[model samples]
Target: MKRLTITTLLAVAILSGCSSTEEVVPDVPPAELYVTAQQALQSGSWTTAIERLETLDSRYPFGAYSEQVQLDLIYAYYKNDDLALGEATIARFNRLNPAHEKSDWVLYMRGLTQMAQDRSFMHDIFSIDRHDRDPEPARKAFRDFKRLLDRYPNSQYAADAKARMIFIKNRLADYDLATVDFYIRREAWIAAINRSQQIQKLYPDTQAARKSLPLMLTAYEKLGLQEPIENTKKLIALNPVN
Candidate 1:
């Protein structure tokens, strides 16, 4: 009977221990998870960090750390080189928290992400190892930089974005001039003139248009197009020094 009583007590103790273990398995709060994610990011485990951060954002959308996690997840995506995802996350953050303290950072990151995505195409043609003529990516980077400058003129990123914008605009004007020159070589006066007109209208401040106007006027004279000659004369009158 004493053995039976002892076994009963042992079972009760075991049950009590199991209950206490279950109760002691604490719920990890969102802030703790965010800290873990930050640690993972700092350690360069970007994928794991993203997973943890995404979980924190998803499971604790209303938690105190929710907004911060939303912003950090954009960084996580960028660190992982998932630019499309990063951009989408930034758009979501902007739409949801337009006046968030770090909104400027979000805008800056979006522009940076676009610039990174197009870095390869922004290089000079002589520097390119491949023969592909795709300039669309560079064009996109320019647009992104311009958007940042226009939207957040006083942002911390404004100066850098402006610099990049100038570089991209110059490159784009160069590309347009090259296209016009190619048409000129082929005796495609109309195409050449149209391209020059576009550069003058779209990028009036660019050196390309300033330099191309004289050539375009000569092309119009060669083509015997009276209207174009008159238009070229008008353009020269408007942009007198160029």
Candidate 2:
């Protein structure tokens, strides 16, 4: 009886150990989870896709698939129109995997986020009507595009970034020229000349600067600034587009 009782206790111990091991074991592999997330993305279920990808990242942080999931999470956020979250996730991915294969894509996405955050023309019109021209978003977009150009000059998005930078620069120059025009209208020739000089110095190649030169020349004449008039002439002769 004692031997039988001892055997039963041993059997119970073995069964308990097996049950514990089974409980600890994962039901689905990380790869399976990743595939499900991809399927969710393909199905246009962005929230679910992001959730699964995030889960994979947390559970299998050091796996090769985790890195891919991190990138996928960025895309998922972008697809969901969550630009702020997408940017944040991309930044985190960049910090973790600076040398990742898709780092260029991350940079490009960041630039796109900045572009998206820019105020619309309608908003600009509203602000202008209210005499509250908030140009901060445009300025931020310019800075972000500049960063992309400087850091990833050879990236696939570099050309687009450069084009956008040119566009932003032109807009900025236009704003400056408008201010100078206002000063000229007020007979503040010195102020007008200074504003034009500022544009010329900062954005020599912009069309706004070219357009401002003739006005600048007029301002210099009205202000009786001979040296500036000659310098303006020299600039026009050098540029030949004014």
Candidate 3:
């Protein structure tokens, strides 16, 4: 009786271990999963949409809805504010479907995602200068949008992309001006002058260009450089202050 009781306990332990290894949730149908994800997305339940979409992607890697699922995942990741994941998803899509009929849209979305990532609560809501933060995302967004426009000039998103690119350009120029200002404050006259001149050369017709001329003039005056001082005055005379 003692031997039989020990054997029963061992058998029960083995069955419990097996049960633990089994999947708790059954596989959901691909169509059903996609629909549920779509519903969640429409309702602004981004996290739930991500989970459902990811499940569909993993389970139906070669299923009928694979392509759309990948695109939806990118959107879900973006809306969920998972910038890194969204970037990865779009990169994967680009790699897999470089020749996709809707490639233009994908490029537009990628640029949009980068722009969104660059947005900061401190900069937007609190009115902090964007120049105080990292400029990588905005620069990347500019490049992406440029690529889209170059490749698909007639794309439906071209006009909006161009507008965003202009905004990013101004923001980048402002960042450069901030650096120039920092140099000026430190009494690094030459560095400040060079940076100011660079902004004017690189971002012509921008407000930064208009602003940089005065900064360069200040730096030249500090250094007692007569030639550059006169040159900057001429530039200021040529350009209208906005």
- Candidate 3 per-residue lDDT, tens place, 1-242, comes to 98798678768867975774322324777878788889999999887788888888788788898889889888888877787898898899889888999899889889989998787643554466567577899999999999999999999999999999999999889988889888989999889988988888889979988988888899999989899789889999999677
Which pairs of residues collide in candidate 3?
A: none
lDDT of 2 at 119: 45
Residue-level lDDT of model 2, residues 52-171, one tens digit each, is 887787788899797788778888887776778888888888888888776777777776666655544345533543212444555777887787778778888888888888877777
Candidate 2 residue spans exceeding 4 A from truth: 1-33, 40-64, 121-153, 178-191, 214-242
My TM-score estimates for the predictions, one after another, are 0.65, 0.60, 0.85
Lowest-lDDT window of 10 residues in candidate 2? 125-134
Give the candidate number with the greatest lDDT: 3
lDDT of 3 at 146: 100
The deviation in Å at residue 113 for candidate 2 is 1.6
**What lDDT does candidate 1 reach at residue 37?**
85
